[model samples]
Target: MSHSTAFASQADLAEKKTSFTQLSANAWAYTAEGDPNSGVIVGDDSVMVIDATATPVMAAALVRRIREVTDLPIRHVVLTHYHAVRVLGAAGFVPEGAVNVIASRATRDLIVERGAEDMASEIGRFPRLFQAQESIPGLTWPTLVFEKELTLHLGSLEVRLLHLGAGHTSGDSIAWIPSQGIVFSGDLVEFNAGVYTGDAHLAAWPDTLDRLAALQPQQLVPGRGPALRTPADSLSAIAYTRDWVQTLLQCARDGVAAGHTLQQVYADTRRVMDPVFGQVFIYEHCIPFDVSRAYDEARGIANPRIWTDVRDREMWAAIQS
Candidate 1:
């Protein structure tokens, strides 16, 4: 095997221009090209932010964008999952009276169990994403935890926080605004961008996507990529993610059944998926991790291994080299 860069993302230092688009009268999406996106919902008296950016400094810019549209206080910060890039920016919202950081019970547990290790691993893998790494106070824990679903009323607007099974992570959740037919799907759905299945439940992801599509959301703010404004776009995003996950897992399962090693499986899966998704954002950065997890699941590993900086390098070496 030939040695390659430990992580493809190590060289991804270029900055992306941010866009803040209003999806509805009250909901807005703050996206930076294909970087992790944040969703903001303005209510009668306050605001609720879904998925804080990677750092406090980065999140401050999101707050500034929100201020440009409304002066409402940012009262809530929601973590779609326990990923470091999404939750580490909770502190940035404190100055805006961010009283509640909400997440599913499983997300809270994952944070307690591996948040520190994940923080280090993610920062090392994608340094460009964590702009002000020092600004992250510590692990961002949730103030409120729910089992399956929790509904909140931001003034008169109703927001439904639901854990519709697992895909990107065991505790993946989405914010659904029923009245407006809008859903803020975390990493559970990505449009024309690579899906990071590093910690994903590959076998269960397709079903979770089915549930998300059944919502019939007219507008959706995905975890990455541009916001899906039309119902057709929303449905397309769900179908695209579903196909990606299913295809990857099928390749892994076929490789395992044929007794291929991890590296071979990775290569085979890449050959199948690259033509379809290689040009998508972060596709190269995510493939090694995605295929590794898919291979594990196909071989009967129900849970993903914890990723540290050391493990990330080892995995990359094993697969890439």
Candidate 2:
């Protein structure tokens, strides 16, 4: 499409209405033109929402949707990862002491160390998502921390949260409701949305997908796309995410082996990935930084370097210019 045509297409997409996509009997997925995802799992007596979007105002809107679905008190708010957009709006679910917020231990550590900078970066990227910054007091800390896995019974419902290993982030968790056969694979499985492998473990992501596939979820709520209803759809989601991560990893490895600078690798990545994933959400804002981070990992760099505000501006200017 021409540039003007593409702009019109995006404008149409943005002007669409926001509604909940129900995958299974009581499982719900939320999609706005925003950061991260919000999932609502309604149980017997209460509801558990996964990933709180970006801020309170955004989350309040999600809450309104949940109220539309079921009147169950949102007893628990779960954090699938430590991203600012996902966890900061947790207060919108319930107050600190009243509701149990869950997250992986590594994610908790990441929030403490890099939370502020990440919050700043993501808000800068997706302004509409973080509707009211001042409404956010600070970072939302998880009240309950799990190492690898934890199972909880909310009244009569069974909710399983598993840390499948390092993939999208060091502390990614997949919430599975086996009885309902619905798995909330946050950011780990992208559908039409881009696979955002910035703080990712390139080599480990596939293994995590392998684990996700083994579970054979009948319904999947992906981080940023439409809900997957059948087993085929679920597997396809995981496969596409795996393929995207591996493609970037191999590209970065090849570029590094050829002694390419970060800029050269970024250019090559866009040259390659644009044909497949270039039109997804935040593709322009995310791809170059994703390439740079993957390049750093390919060069044997471990533990993502902290992305401070100044560093973000410097990186964006370097990549965009």
lDDT of each candidate versus the true structure: 0.92, 0.81
Q: Write the per-residue lDDT of candidate 2 for residues 231-304, one digit (tens) a residue.
A: 99999999989988998989999999999988788888777888998777666656756787899999999888
**Top model number, TM-score:** 1
User: The CA-based lDDT of model 2 is what?
Assistant: 0.81
Candidate 1: clashing residue pairs, number: 0
Worst 10 residues of 2 by lDDT: 1-10
Q: Which candidate ranks first by lDDT, i.e. highest?
A: 1
Compute the lDDT of residue 130 as modeled in candidate 2.
64
Local accuracy of candidate 1 as per-residue lDDT tens digits, 1-321: 232465759888899999999888999999989999999999998899999889999999998999999998899899999999999999999988746999999999999989999999999999999998999999998999999999999999999999999899999999999999999999999998999999999989999988998999999999999999899999999989999999999999999999999999988887889889988999888889999999999999998999999999998888876
**Model 1 residue 71 lDDT?**
92
